[model samples]
Target: MSIDSQKGAGLPAQGTPPVVPPSAPHSAVEKQVARSYNSAVANETLEDYSLRYAPKSFRRWSEYTVATTALGGIAYLADFAIGASIAISHGFENALASVLVAALVIFLTGIPISYYSARYNIDMDLLTRAAGFGYLGSTLTSIVYASFTFIFFALEGSIMAQAFHLGFGLPLWIGYAVASLIVIPIVIFGMTAMAKLQVWTQPVWLTLMFAPFVFVAIKDPHSYAAFTHWSGGTDVKGGSTFSAVGFGAGMGVALSLIAQIGEQVDYLRFMPDKTAANAKKWWTAVLAAGPGWVVLGAFKQIGGAFLAFLIVASAGTVVADEPIEQFRHGLGVYITAGTLGVAVFFVVLSQIKINVVNAYSGSLSWSNFFSRLLHYHPGRVVWIFFNIGIALTLMEANVFSFLNTVLGFYSNVAIAWIGAIVADLVINKPLGLSPSIVEFKRAHLYNFNPVGFVSMLIGSAVSIVAFEWGFGHGTFGTYAQAFSPFIALALAFVLSPVFAVLTKGKYYIAREDTLPEPLTVDGQLSGVSMECGVCTDHFERPDMAYCPFHSSAICSLCCSLDKACHDMCKKGGASSGPVDLTLTRASS
Candidate 1:
């Protein structure tokens, strides 16, 4: 055929649909290979991106706009309660010093994590998996991260319950249940609606939070002077003598917020793609919404400490750590008739803002957890209710009464998890011990990797032992008592490189999966859609892998959930019998 005739024949006829070959990257073979699996096809919504990547197309919001919405969640007044409680238990100097140290560590660690998540568009779970912890190894962090969410959820819920009791004479039990359940609908829509909720309430929450502080400062400057010298008299250390032991204990509680970086990056993952044109805007948003949470958090903690002292000065009592009581008494000094009303409104608003973020993040954590452990996929929405149920139970168990002990204990594990991750990213990757880029697909990773998993395990065990003083009665016990978090972080950081060297970084990549046929279009964004054969749904290019078991392309979620494949797509993976997913759900 002549060249002109070939060109005319190659093009689709006028007004006729173009023919897409089944062998092409975006073939029309999506729903043809395997049986329909579960409700994953039905669950797609504004839940942003759960158990999947946030593609370029889904990232429609500007960097600054998303940052503003994400930053607003930090207005949770639990910082007020936690700051007051620690300052009362351990002196002002110890608590303040501890807060500064913890904030510094959290900010430094958050930077690499935030950059990777925004640049690659993955959540903490996927980041952990690709960093050094293997596919199943990262599930341990998933459970730990999930626990952080619910623990904070329960703590924030208790604050809201107290607000309810003070405002409406509601019973504490009923208030706890109400506070726990009210966030379900708000978070069900995920970032889209949740972002709006936080943005709209930011103005009201900021006004109310600062109003009492400004009012108190202007009305009675003497209270500030009184606040400086008020030492919470304790049986240990004899009233704020700046003991090393006190600083360590206080720091243990403060460092629990380190894991909160996970929740922040969940939103940052949806940030619009950074380009040469918007590079400055992107970095500003990442820092402000990422590590900047703690900058504001540290300030609020100091504010809370001062507020507690003001309550002590005015009310002649040092027991004002409870948020409802602190706000009630602080506002009472200036407002005449409706002080309780104003205090209750601010407290409730603050709790709602933080709890929504907590609940939403918890749901994501739970989804990662169950999806891995059970090998049966349920929608993220189902896990939202499960997470709330656990938090509600924790609230009823009275987590607030023992907040210091709980957070101090949790801080050890939280920091250890973060330390291992940070060490892997900063130390191992650049040293040529591990892969340079993140490979998160299940087909590309081992079931578990010892580099991160073993490091976190040993770190947690050593820290917990020190927390309980497993060291014999000697200089070691004294050191352990004052350096628990420091000990855990140092151990994890040091051990990660050692483990990486020992393992030779062999477990980082399972298979290269060099496909015979391309899984992506030649010239398009990674968001170009490819259909999953099993689920009968389209997913972004990165999320779709060519499945040898099904002999077609399938989404990564379906691949991860496929027990029948038994990782047969990878080397030495033999095919197994298919799992009855419905029966698995029923038995559970």
Candidate 2:
């Protein structure tokens, strides 16, 4: 298909159109202005289309490459810490069962979320906008996702700081600053730099990560048996056996990592469009790197538990949960000389690998959140510092000391948000309660959609109550308090479909896709390029949407940033009042 050579018919020529005298009222073109960004934001390489759809032209990575990068980001050591913490609080059996259960839930829910993101080449924020949350409704989800990034960033940064303190005599505060500041230069380049960094470092990182585990198995095979018997010297309520309360509380801590799938999808959004020729490789990549991250993560958590068991027998519970201390003892099994140095190296490498993703994905999340709320986007690069600064503050506050408390409390809200989106993608779409396709462009979405927005709010509210206060009393309250994450998940999942039916799915699309060119041609996204009426820049067909104010096609970013239009296109459907969305309960 040919690129549209002309600007919008409604827009005049490139130079200022000759109209009335200079003192006259501003021309129509002047009234059609939008907040613009610098070249840094406009350049796709640096920005990576943070707040807009990633076009087909830019998705050039091979399936293996994309999958490898996505999986590489999962090389964090937090799973070990989380597992160790859970095991210290609850015994081996409960921790094991909880981690496994949480892994299964995350894997199952992540399948639909990752598939839709890879298929549509949009980030989780954009996907949320169309899946069930409407345009503005997704801003809340963007904040949720952004919080996940910085929270993990602080956690990972803390781990790295611990390495600095152990390997060198650096103060913990100085180390925190060092760890937080280093990733800025790397993350500023976005995917172009990350793709290379993740790929090049994968082999060495993998070898370092597994070396201690393999050596431990070889040197002391009986340690595995001993771990199942050791209990971190705690009275573990059930005493190494599984208890319902222990299992539920442990699951809540483990499920906090559900938001990790969002970071994975942040990379999966770059996957090349699948075709018959690449079908095998594409599916393999998606399944392996998308939801398949949990497989490796589960092992890491279990491995962390074993390592903690080895150390806590002598090091005490406080030292056992720290990744640096856990690894030092585990790797000391064979590397008798300079064990601290070796372990510190591994910890630092692991932290860098994961924190880069944390910072990068956080920038995207912040960019998405602020753009809609403030209608001002300096650039994706600017937000990298904002995300890291928050993380550094949390790190200085010693966030890692209370890791389980933070993660466990956070799981309720995170699970609810992810659960609502998963339901829309997997259940509602299949049952015809929601649209089959993802319509993410701003021009085509309502301000809010109850199908996802209300479901998530109710789920979060109920689960948070369960988490804080429990149900009524007795055994039921104990279970409810412990399993609040699951409560959020179940409520959101069921209610998404219920709300979709009640709302009649009208809010999913605010206006029909009346653009001249079809989104897809011959079963694939059309490669046709169109000029944005506002920005006057060209974007692929998927990123372009018709603007009634412009009377021509405009790019999604321009539509998102335009404060002047006030959604004149959507307003036409409703005469005097707000758009008649059941989500808002407003009518003309």
Candidate 3:
């Protein structure tokens, strides 16, 4: 008998191979199957590279190099701008407390996310899919993650445009276009190109960034004390008493950065396999640069806060609110030669490095979202433009004025997703509530899981209510904002274990015995290879798979996007329980 007919012996098949069944009950699985097929067809170099499984051969870089390259993207000047803006608006005391609280939270949350990505070599999309979101549920979070990348891309690109307008007298429109287009070619090559670009730019960027601060410290020692006492815009009520609500709101805005761990993990996935010799460096790099990004970010924010205070004291209220204006005034204290030109040049250069990263990460996010939802991936290159196009539109519409509103609104959604994922990774995995290793492939995952989905929905709903209710409005409207991220994290942590107990971990892995290949000392799958049915290319054991619908072994990428099969081959036999029931009826 044909392999297809043999596999379908229990069920009646009118025509065609049993593996690729002619008909089946319609469900979300049908859509998933179609998407998987389409993604397989587009598995060219330009489209859907390394989707289903990460081949060991492709992971060639040293852990340190990968970590450094990833961390370099975080070297954004906008931290300073954000810090300065918050301080000038909220006063020194509030901004300082907010910065401290936000930094601590971001750093702590980043630890588990970074470790898993590095250990498993999977991006956040894959990570979320396995964590608890299930196959289709993760797709929803992918859209949310993509939104974070592009929104930041637009914000960073806008900053670049402003710098261009200041430095070269270019129109903001032209500057925005220039900023968006420049990153496309670099991103086309993906991680390879980004590493070189970030490495080369790091030194010059660091030098320019630190020179002004050093000069300020050496020349005007007395300015430091003035920074602490100066109140730029915040109104003090009843003797400088701390307001929990005001502090919470400011912290929420600053803590919106929690999603940035996704970008960091994208790079960490490239880290070399851990070994006795490389383990020290591997752990060091991961910790130092992984969640450690907040260290630098916090410092920059504080510096921005200090600079804003200095500007208020010197240039008065109008320019104090603008970070660029504040920086220009401060840098002038040091540079006697062409001070205006030097300051503008430094600002422009700093913004370009950061905006490029924003655009690049955004493209990856968009690519993941559309490829899964629409069942077609033109290429990563195509999405780069698609992402940029959105950002460009936002810029033209003058999004800068609405920055706080947009970020505040976005934080609720972003935090919910991040917190849910973190809860699963840190709390669930360790406590035996979820699978230890990430199970990202569609063939190996359920369509939906209640753990992350329920947690995020509940957390976001509550936080939104608190925000709208104005609980912290008495201190500063921003105080009510802090509730979202914490609520999401806390609820997800509590709910994941409960969900695991109820579901009994059946959804964590489809069939554990299916993964029979032996792993190397460092967890690398070994000693087997199979050819993809769609691409007809051979892959290592980890990248190869058997599909019951097609009645053949295929590569992981092919299985991921195959839309035709309807998942006829699952654990033990056919796709669904009804099919097996039908077979028993026929036999009787």
Candidate 4:
């Protein structure tokens, strides 16, 4: 959390210890080292493509490129739809205020979370593992994180389906299939392919997005004032009354977006290695494009609210209620002619841009879940279909009709998971209650850690209760619902430190002493390159390592998938000794 603490720690000096060769005696210690090495270093396309290790070689892209790619995912038109829905239901003033509050909280928590993931070359799953969730503890959170991706994928796909219905008169079933299928090919190659797709599409997406607003303002200056004065659809006067409990509950629903930082961190982990030459750009890009996503999101929400008001004023009561209808009306007001065609074109373009990100992130999440749970990774490409299949089922079931109920219930769990992660990254590490470096390998982590698990459990339980009960139903109820996100945030932040202290930081790192020292020249760490055992290709020093299990120096990607070792080296066992010695000892 503090740069001052990280700086000035010179690399291990020369002769401090010779590089431990992979040929070390086949003792329990050597076996443990081998398991750790193998677990952390395995398949580049599959492991690094999802949730395992992040090697220096993969972090070759510049910070701007990385950040831009990550932020590009936020171009989804859903923000506008969500903002407009909230405005119509809750009133414009209330929606605007709530959105601002949510953005601020997301930004503050995102700073530490984003920075750590990029700096450590770890994704959210791995970061959670080292931050006190332990190995298995974080697995539960991975399921939660994975659910966030798929749920949003369905939502984004549903929006695109609407566009298909409008533009081509396609049945919803066909539209869902089309929307889901198009993204699979784009995501099959992972970040390499996604980066190019995002870069190429972003400029046009942005231009189309704001062009209507510019036209609206230029043609009728009075419309802006009319929008500001709009009272809204709800009968309850002047927005819901301010109450701690009500505010908390409403904010909790909005704050479910905290999990989005996980997706952003996915790209950020690809940021170029932070050397002295690139530190400034790295920090700036990461901070701006990482957590800074909330800023643009907040604006979109407010813009949606404004557009919704305009639609209601111009089109009629019925049209204002439907998001597609609202957008159609807004386009009509701006376009001179071909209003229907322009509206359909804008909707399809926006939906495609956002849906690709949704499908892409979901595939990564599904990949992480199946690989760890089933121990069989078909490939990142396979998971894309798996994720889309889930979304297609949701569409068939007509999930959109219950969007409010679904999102509200989902927010509780989503906030809890994100809250625990942010707390560990921001509070535990700074207080020295957790390890400075992230330890993600199965061999170097306990199956469960209480710090993150307990925090998430507590936060979720309280928020769900507050949401279900009308504790803030009266004058105070509105405020409670609106501020629930802060409640979850506070609870997780406080609990993480408390739990870490209670546990005495024992679970933070499973095997500290066993980790190999950094490759160094003189007193400073100098970059060295080595070949990956699996791919038979060269990688940077941080990516290449010696593994004693297969008795070869393997890459991080190969280590993730080499289940043959059976984690024998991680813990002292019969397999830790040489084959001949173990057989002779057993017979004796």
Candidate 5:
């Protein structure tokens, strides 16, 4: 046998997995689970990188490439529709105020979250595991993030369907499937395919995206007057003037995209290793791609409002908010031949670009979610089909018509989730209530951490109750509905710090990060290559974990699926222990 063959053939992958004694025999079930993990990784390429940290080698894309690709995901026309919906319901003053406030909040929260995810080379799900959620705790976040994707996917797909219906004379049902199915092939290759598509189509998309608005702005001044004065005839509801209540409600709808930062980080993680020489380029790309998405989204929404107003007389309130209809009318001023056809082309192009991202991010989210719950492994490709299927169903059910209602409810929970994360990163860790470094490995974390999980649960529940049931009678109930998300955000921010102080950061870290030298060629460990002792498979270090049951390093998927060994490695199994300052924090 070769020297490499003998390297880890019989010996354990070595840091003596803290689990059962080294001499304990491996169970048949343990062996089976390990084999399954190896298979899962082998089949999951389109995910770009999943289940663990993206390695340096895989970080081959330039900063510009990753940033632009992430930005491309924001090219969806839903923002336009959302903007139009709010303006028509709330009037110009409230809608404008809503967009600015929501954009500011989303941007602020995005800064730290984006920087850390990119610096650590982890996606939001993995980052959540360390930030505060802990092992099984992040499962809730995974589901919430997944819901955002499919909901947005369905909304975007609906827009595409409408375009097809108007242009090609296709049925909405077939258009829904067509819009949903076309994205599958693009996303199956993960970031690799997504980057190419976004970059190639960007110039054309930008020209088409901005051209209609510029033309309308240049040629039609009366449209602006109508937008400022119109309120979709909601005068009795106080829609003609600025209402604090209306602004808050509209803001809730816009902030629902706070979860979109997760999709951005998914691509930013692939940004090439930051070097001193490229420092300027690195930070620029990270900032632009990360939370910077809403900057573009906010303006596009304003444009959507303007265009919707331009067509409200002809299209009416029911159809005015549709991007297909808005753009068709906007383009009518400029084009004489195939006017509807040209408008449909731009709308279809926009939806395809954005839905691919929705589909891709949803797959990543579901992969993280089910892997933690089932302990059984299926590749991410399976989840892509699963994610798209859910969105397609929503499209068939006509989810787009109830846009504001769906998004308003969803934003409250999403705000809570994002708020807790931000609090942990900005406040808790800085105040010395928690560990500064993020410890994501399962063996090194508790199953739940109240700093984020408990806070999130309470915040989401309170906001939901307020959003649905009246907080008080008459005027107060209106305030409660509009300000629902602020309640979630404020409570999460306060509760996270409170929980950290109460718990004394005891649940933050389990055991220290101790990697086996045998699995790494160098003294230090990395995500490059490490051999799993049970399957004796060469796997990435990010996928490998120190397991005492087998007295070796096992891949995460195997460790999750293993039915035995029972987490004995961390001194107290299942139950968490306080952090030991003596153990020393790991440096990134």
Candidate 6:
């Protein structure tokens, strides 16, 4: 909790050249190799504090605005498609049970994560780093979270492309390009542009999304009654009866979206600090925009199921799950004159709203992943193109063709990763087994923490085995394949605490915080700013850590990029002796 002034004894004064130690090579130690980011990365407006803590100084939006913007990003049609697909495979009875179960699980798990990210002002990557996965250890979860963004991005883009094909007579290839390219201009500006875009279009999107359903109720009242008895297709076993295996299969596909909370927290990180005066509004906003997203998402899935049931006989089951097709037939029930145009417009808007968020969150995760590995960061804007390009490639390859298979297989890994993090945040921290406060800086965290990282690995490995080969090959295999996601979640949750106790929580923090300034003031992250000795840029207090090697305060970005330091400040490098790796109880 106190600064180690003795470590800077032999170190030269700030802004002065230090005496080169004879024990090390002189060439590499002569100059401070600090990282310099471009204007896009340096400025909070363009970068939105990507790859670092979202300081209080930059989190200026009101709770209502932040909540709306976060919820706006969830305006995707994929839920409808996912719901329709699950129903098609598992019949109405099983699909209904599965969807509700998945939604409940997602909502409960999302609560702790959302609260932490909003309170701490850090993205999912930083949260993971401190929540059991260490600095380098979080790199694994970063890739897992990044994959979620792009896979969904491609799926949403493919849906948008279908709209283009339906309305403009564009070929699927050209439509794919259009869908991928449209979000670039908007996403280039980061949260500033995205907030405006989402807020302005939300009303219109909502109107179009629900208009068809309202009209169908008035025009075809009997359709709703008939849909209740729709026992999937002839392919489904046992007609409309529910089956345990079928429910589990549906849950696996629905649970693939466990990582969607990462996207929610990507925005939740910007939530203004909650004060007593705004406590009511703060909790409401966080819950609604965070876990509350699944409420609407579940409804959309059911709505998609209803719409697909209406048009399956006419359009065939193959295209029933496509969002563009679902909306086309739904809107056609009332707006006969320009149904295609309206449906295409709605699809394009929904895709753009959600894809920008997908692209934005992807850039953040990729930035975190590459920064730790390469020790270099050009800018966050650069990664937007990289994320979109990958999604575009997937679209070109027609990734939408194998949606169920891809999502089902992916759910195992996603659930395991998220489950481990949730266990750390909810169980380990509260039980005084791990650090209560999220310590995300590279200076304090170990390279790897077995508590969450190994638990996630074990959970993912076992669940993937269950999903692919299924325990053995008989009835066990069938049940295992159907319930692999549940297995992954349970193992990760149980193992996180077990590993924390086994490791004695020593791996959680490499060294105690040595910054001179307090991390917070009056129960809130301090707005006091400090200048980075290496980067020569001013950053907020939470982002700055004392660097014994440089004999000055350094920003986290500069600390992360300083290759020559070798973390001497924490490890007792050239100037300081190795610090004790003791387990300390962090403040609640």
Query: In order, how many clashes per candidate?
Result: 0, 0, 10, 42, 4, 2
Clashes of 5: 4
- lDDT, candidate 3, equals 0.67
Question: What lDDT, from 0 to 1, does candidate 1 have?
Answer: 0.77
TM-score on alpha carbons, each prediction: 0.88, 0.92, 0.85, 0.83, 0.90, 0.92
Candidate 3 C-alpha lDDT tens digits along 1-588 = 111122222122333222344343443444244223244235443332435455566777887678778877886666776676666656667778988988998898889888887877778888888888887788888778777777777777777777778778889899888877877776666777778877887888778777767878989878777677645553222233355655666666677677888888877877886668888999998887789989888988888777776666556654454546656767777878777677777666666566666666666676666656665556566777887898888888767656656766677777888778888887777676776656677665667877887777787777776666645566444544555556655666677767776776556555332333333323444524555544556565555555545434456556656666555555332232122222111110
Give the C-alpha miss distance for residue 24 in model 6, angstroms.
11
Q: Across residues 1-588, which tens digit of lDDT does each residue of candidate 1 receive?
A: 211122222111232222222343323343345556445435556345688888766777888768977887787877887788778877677878888998999999999899888877889999999877899999999999999999999999998998899799999999999998888888888888878888788888888888778888878878666555545643222345576777888888889999999999988988887778888999999999999999989988878877877665444333477778888877877888899989998888888898888888888888887778787656777788888899999999999889888998888898999999999889987786776666678866788888899999999889998987747578779779567887889999899989888888877766554432222233222555666667666667667666656656667788778776566555542222322333211110
**Candidate 5 residue-wise lDDT, 1-588, digit = tens:** 221222222111223333435443454445455453344357546546677678765777888999999999999999999999998888788888999999999999999999878876889998898777888999999999999999999999999999999999999999999999988888888888888999999999999888887777778866666667666433322335788988998999999989999999988878776667888999999999998999999998888888877777667789989999988888877777888988998998899899989988898889888877886557778888999999999999999989999999999999999999999999987786777666677776778988899999999889988898848679888788789899999999899989988887777776654563322233222545666666565656555567666656666666665555556766653222222212211222
Alpha-carbon lDDT, every model: 0.77, 0.84, 0.67, 0.66, 0.80, 0.84
Candidates 1 and 5 compared: the better one by lDDT is 5
RMSD values for the candidates in order, in angstroms, are 9.4, 7.7, 7.8, 6.9, 6.8, 6.0
Shift in Å, residue 527, candidate 2: 1.2
Candidate 6 regions exceeding 4 Å error are 1-35, 234-239, 572-588
The TM-score, computed over Cα atoms with residue i paired to residue i, of candidate 4 is 0.83
Write the candidate numbers in order of decreasing TM-score: 6, 2, 5, 1, 3, 4
Which of candidates 1 and 3 reaches a greater lDDT? Answer: 1
lDDT, model 6, position 223 = 81
lDDT (10s digit) by residue, model 6, range 1-588: 212322222122333222233243443453346546778887778788887789876788899889999999999999999999888777788888889999999999999999999998999999999888999999999889989999999999999999898888999999999999999999989889998998899999899989989989989988877776668863322347789999999999999888999999999999998899999999999999999999999899888888888777777789999988888888888876988888888999999999999999999999899889888788888889999999999999999989989899899999998899999988887786886767788876778998899999999999999999998989989999899999999999999999988876777766655555666777788777776766767778778776666655667887787687676655532222222212111222
Candidate 3 stretches with Cα past 4 Å from truth are 1-50, 234-241, 313-323, 471-482, 513-516, 519-522, 525-529, 570-588
